[model samples]
Target: MIVADGLEKTFWHRPNAKGVLGSFRALFSGVGSAKKAVESVSFAIEEGEFVGYLGPNGAGKSTTIKMLVGILHPSAGSVEVAGMSPQLQRREVAKKIGVVFGQRTQLWWDLPVRDSFEILQAMYQVDEKQYALAMERYDDLLELGSFINTPVRKLSLGQRMRADLAAALLHDPAILFLDEPTIGLDVVAKERIRGFLKEINRVERKTILLTTHDMDDIAELCQRIIVINHGKLVMDGSLSALREQIGLPTTCTVQFASTPQIQQIRGIERIETNGMQVQVFYDKRTISTPVILDEISKWGDPLDITLAEPEIEELIRRIY
Candidate 1:
């Protein structure tokens, strides 16, 4: 549903200086530096796909998102949303897309949350029947009725976020661009948003491109990932394939009654003994889980065991 080819963005700004005159002199002298926030990035996201656009700070993630949403024009490439060029046809593109930036709300600041929804409904020119259905669906999914009468500015962060989500979806857009949608939310609030996104993608066939620092968001919500660093594409594939490309080790933490002299096993990347616990990192592709369990049984009587996959950050860091 989204296509980007050789997409890039560059910002020209004067270098920092001690004073205004120094900055002015640098600017007038044509000495400003051009920083390429995104360079030659290319990727395609299909309909109903949830893709994570992941990277560290200053890694061009937001720049790429802005370009895709038509908030910023690209410097050297093209992007199309649902077969329409977002830059050339932003109004139509906006009609098909919904956006949520976690740090900001699109809702009117001083209006009641219900008023904001009404305003959006009118602005979108939604049919009365369709609007009613949308409101009913979102009120059930997002619990908007609880805070509908509250002012947007008076709602808590989580409440405001949920209200914003409802507002965004009131028009029944088919695509969503979520930039850190769970930022600053508590565990419960984050999970609520995650579940909502997953359901929206699965049941409604919505295409979502999410940019988040929280690895949990990527792990739980995204089916595929596109990682970038320093304005370049690093990885783009399934979550498992990305992890395998990075060679992330699967960990098994086993607790025994006592430490044992566990002989080294092939395919075991590393092993550590902490009193009554044995921590093992292994290559799952090389050795099966049964093999690891058997080896651990032989080492000592395992009282407890837990397995874990590598964190998303670990896989993203591989590009560095």
Candidate 2:
């Protein structure tokens, strides 16, 4: 549904001059430093796919999204949405895509949420039946009815985000672009939004492109991941593939009744101990958790045990 082939975006920064005359001279000089925000990044997202675009700050994720949405034109290469060039067919591409930026809202700040939806419905030229259906579906999924009549400026951040998601989907676009959709939200609010997104992707088959720093969001929502660093594509594959590439170890922390003698075990990478507690690290691919637990039992009587899988953050750190 989305294709970015050798996509590149460069931003030029002009040096500031000390005086007005110098500034004017510098402006016309056409001499400035060029920074490539996105360089030769390539990826394709299929229809109904939930792809996570990941990178550290200044990693060119937002630049790529802007190019895909036709908000910013690419300096080099090309991007297509729904088999149409977004830059050349911006209006048609806009009709096929819905975008939600967490820090910005498309609604009128002083207007009620319902009014905002109505305005968007008109802008998208949605029919009455489709608008009603969208409202009903989003209301059920997003719980927008409670704050539907509330002014946007009066709503809380979570409420405003929910409203924004509803507004974006009101036209029933085939593709969704979400930039940090759950940022600054509490645990409950984030989960609510995640659930709503999951439902829509599953039942309605909406193609979603999500850019988020929250590892939990990637773990729970995205089926594929594309990682970028220094304006270049770093990795693109499934979550499991990323984990395997990084070879992140599984951890088992055990609280023993007394300190036990640590011994080398096959598949066990290393062991650390503090007082009565022992921490074991092992590659889960080489051995099972049950086997590790069983081996630990031979040394001492355990009081408590906790096992943790490698986190998505750790995997991403490895990529960066």
Best by lDDT: 2
Q: 1-320 in candidate 2: lDDT tens per residue?
A: 99999999999999999899999999999999999999999999999999999999999988898999999999999999999999999999999999999989999999999999999999999999999999998898989889999999999999999999998898889999999999999999999999999998999899999999999999999999999999999999999888878889989999988878666788788998899899999998899998999899998889999998798988999889
Q: Each candidate's TM vs. the true structure?
A: 0.93, 0.94
TM-score of 1: 0.93
Residue-level lDDT tens digits of model 1 in 1-320 = 99999999999987777788887888788877789999999999999999999888999999998999899999999999989999999999989999999999999999999899989989889888998999898888888888899888899899999998888888999899999899999999999989898889999999999999998999899999898999999889998998788778899999898877688998889998888888899988899889999988998788899999888777777665
- The residue ranges of model 1 lying beyond 4 angstroms of the native Cα positions read 16-29, 257-261
lDDT of each: 0.90, 0.93
Model 2 spans > 4 angstroms off: 255-261, 285-291, 301-305
